[model samples]
Target: MGWGGGRVLRDRNVVFYLSGVVVSGFGSSAMSLAAGVWTKSLTGSDSLAALTTFCVWAPILLGPVIGTLADRARRRPLLIWTNLGMAMVLLPLLAVHSSDQIWILFAVLTVYGISSVLLDAAEAALVATVVPETLRGDFNGLRMTANEGMKLVAPLLGALLFVQFGGTAVALLDAVTFVLAAMAFTLIRVSEPAPRPAKAQKWSAQVAEGIRCLRHQPALWRLVLAGAATMGVAGLNGASVYAVVDAGLHRPPAFAGVLYAVQGIGSVVIGLFSGALLRRMPERGFAAAGIMLFALGVALRVVPSAPVVLIASAMIGAGLPCVLIAAMTAVQRETPGDLLGRVAATANTLLFAPNAVALVAGAGLLALVGHDVLLLVAGAAAATAAIGCLLGSGTRAPAAAPALGGSVRVEDGGAEGSETAHDSR
Candidate 1:
């Protein structure tokens, strides 16, 4: 089709959605960097600094339930309201006078976290509705690239703002971005296809349906497990910040910020080449490689030196995007459009539940075995995931060619079974 003929960008709805996301992502990244640094500075406790990361990810563990609500309701309204609500929450941070008000910061972060769950689920469902199947991979890649690009600049900018002005100033900027994003969303008029009558049931029934839908998908389950393992490792890595400082490094604060920026750079690099790579390799293969690389990188943190750890951090960052891209692409390709929101949510929950566990565990573990042991655990988990992927190759399959207007069937072990297919627009 031509640019104006049934293409994704030609769909005014998608254009509006993408526009809003790009704007809001800029603010979100800024908030993340500012909050992390501010909280660390305020508490003078690495455990508390890690809480910022925990708060940001905590809601994702509840993503399936949030996604179900999105699927059952009008997604556009949810998207618009969530963004506005998030902006309002940032207002409280503007008034913080001292580090003692850390609870207030946590509260604001909690609100932001819930808003993120809603926004992400709505966006995923909306994209499936607006974009054509043929372009889903490219569209998703584009979205990922835009978000990473914003991240690349937001941290450095936020750091500068923090140094020059304060966290309050950075918070205000975040609020402004959310307001603009909400306004942009308001201008879009997209008619979400009504839920199928059969698909519309009691809330409990719908939730169960989502659960059942995923219960039998072996490949998806494996992917979820791998994602969770990675998150756990990431949690350990976050906890290692204090250890880095403890290892005789001066200005650990500054070094930590630089490490985060480096990771963002790695994400941007992977985003640039993801589309081509996806076409060249199977998703499972990419995931296995990423996991292996991540494992190796984390293992290097066993070294007690600052430079070695810094180099290891870069390697871990570089490997992460590959894993993320591979997993997300698999989900988009395998799930039926109608169940996309719920499935995405479920997958996200699996991905993040470990993060919560990891945070608490990492803190305790750090006190006991120190940073070296923590890194070793993370590396071992990644290695296990890699092995699992390698052994499960028989169950994993490439994305099928898009079928128009109906479900698709696959023969597993020569047994033909029909499964619902998500229509990509």
Candidate 2:
């Protein structure tokens, strides 16, 4: 592979894929913000506002199946076709003219959700193939940074575009980005490692293979549990919009968006330094500390003050990515090349499955008891994650090397190899 554009170093595959991801990410972000605003404008119901999160996350529940397809087939086609399909799905959103058509918007969002599942599975599989095993952590961090960075701007731009040109224009813009992403994928060339089928394995056997892969790894499973629990608690924060607005705070709706931006800033800062952080802190330490911060934030929300709530929200958001990076690093480091997609998808499903439930439950609880009760629920869940991390012995430094030896390598100027080897036992 040669460098592109006389740049001292470049991997064409990474460049092409990164370009596609950045474009697609921006579009997705825009559509996401527009959809939320549209939903709120239509129903003026907090539960419906939370439904946007539900639709976004529901596809993750099918992550295992989507991941299996990615692992089983060629990933390039998956990426290209999914982006194109997503573009088509968004096309109808451009026709929305009235609040009564909110159901149409929901239907379109459901399609987007499905596309997201495929896109995420394909992207994870594709990155695993193109980036060598040694650099997976930094690469993952960089990927998050790019996605979140785009998120930071997408909402502001979407708000402006929606105001100036209407939601139809914003939807059209999202479709164009998808088309561009598909074109970018067309320029990338990398073959995924062939999936090794167990001889005479039945469908059940295949499912077992993926499950067993996760089950035998106690530490990885624990991390998965931790992620699911933490995400569930975070879901409450998302569903608390009504409470925030009812608190009599000036510009409460605006505060939600600003707090989200603050969280993005925190994530970008942590992600940029993730390589160094991962090297110094064990996965257990990172997981525990992150969840603790999140728990503290949720706990503080019980106070019901605007400043305190915003501060807590920011802390919770910042802590989440840190825990996620640590969990993802462990999975990427240990999983085999052929199974990486399935493992990643499986992990993703685990993380999001509870989140979906939490969103619905949080909405219902907010309606039934109140936002304060929801905060208590969120606080309890975060505390559970923190405790789980503390108690799970597998999260600690390995008593001895468990025989898995592989690494992910990214071509970017970021750290080139896995950080695990540098840790002093």
Candidate 3:
């Protein structure tokens, strides 16, 4: 009730930041979809084509380490340079001519992944400083909307570009977008203070601090844990996507795109309303409700009718982003700016890493247990996670963080995070 999306939309910095996210997100989505296709084209093996996705996600394992760099540097420069650097990194993909050179694409993808982690950390921290806290829900929701909106159209555009030109064109397209994103970052108007000097500590210690920050916050941990749970099951669903399309709905393999599009549409709708929903409920409740909806969606997947499958797919899309957006908002509000980058990164690694593991495991499980069993398992795991969150929501009393600068600190019995009260008001 206290936030206005239109007010946030009117801020100049919000406009530029969202612009950068949208542009880069399009490039990222397009590149990711095209990379697998590129690999399949270069080598006839579907296994290797799938490996490209793993290459992109593998850098998330190093999120803690790379995230520390975001804390150490000026976040704006970190963001701008990372985009420019990624632009340079994608150039090598232009030279790939043979399957032997496919390794080059993989290598580039890995670098791209690492840069993405750093970018995420910087963006989270930067948003805390630049955007008003009361409007952060709307701000974050809009950000999600921008990203999901890009995901909706970018791949189709990328595929079209790939077909009309080649992998080189898609690579160049992404590179050009990175350059444009860098330019967009240059346009944001923010007065970020210099980063504090790091105390004498081991690199591992720095990484551990971020992990501890998560552990120290009760609601934040539960939210992230919930996210990781649902994400893992989503991966299980993902591994069985083709199976669902073929065996479940009697649709062809390419029809998987329709289901995916349906999911994206749901995500877009939820993302647009996430801010208002967060206002009405605590972070845990918001996330738990989404997880429950996701559980229903995945559970309904056991029904094989085309109409039911489409509705379930839409529910899956609408439900998945709630926890992630909540976690991001909570971290930004709760963690000190000095520690935000690494903590944000650590949270991300936790929330997303399980999905990667489950993808492989679900694939193996599919060979034996089949898609229906995996879907049910995923649904149950998600429901169990939601119930845990709802039950645990009442137990924790998070300590009030000290005010930094001229900001005020307030804690409303841990229903949600309240970091800088001056901004919050």
Choose the strongest candidate by TM-score. 3
Q: Candidate 2 on 1-425: residue-level lDDT in tens?
A: 11112220145555666677678788888877777777777678766766775677677777776667666766778777877888888878867777787778888887788677767766665655555443445556666666778889987899799888888898899899989988988776544455676467665565556667877898888888898889888877777755665663445466677767877876766666554455455776777788888888777776757788777767876688767777777776667757766777787778768766776678788778767777877788788888888788655452222111223343333432221110000
| Superposed model 1: Cα runs more than 4 Å off | 1-19, 36-54, 92-105, 159-168, 184-191, 197-202, 242-253, 303-311, 393-425
Where does the lowest 10-residue lDDT sum fall in candidate 2?
Answer: 416-425
lDDT of 1 by residue, 246-343 (tens): 66354456677666766666666665555455554567676777778778888887776678777777778767656666666666666776777787
Q: After superposition, how far is residue 90 of candidate 3 from its true place, in Å?
A: 0.9
Q: If ranked by lDDT, best first, what sequence of candidates would result?
A: 3, 2, 1
lDDT of 2 at 10: 46
Point out the higher-scoring one by lDDT: 2 or 3: 3
lDDT of each: 0.68, 0.68, 0.81
**Model 3: per-residue Cα lDDT over 1-425, one tens digit each:** 54455666655556666777788888889998899999999998899999998888999988889889989998888888988999999999999978999999999998888888888888888878766565566778788778888988999999999989999999998998888888877776556788998899999999999889889988788888888988898889888889998888888898999999999899888878887777677778888999999999998987989899999999999899888887788889888998998998888898899999998998899899878988998899999999988887542232222212223221222112111101100
Q: How many backbone clashes does candidate 1 have?
A: 2
Model 3 segments more than 4 A misplaced:
394-425
Q: Whole-model lDDT, candidate 1?
A: 0.68
Q: What is the lDDT of residue 260 in candidate 2?
A: 78
Compute the lDDT of residue 332 as modeled in candidate 2: 69
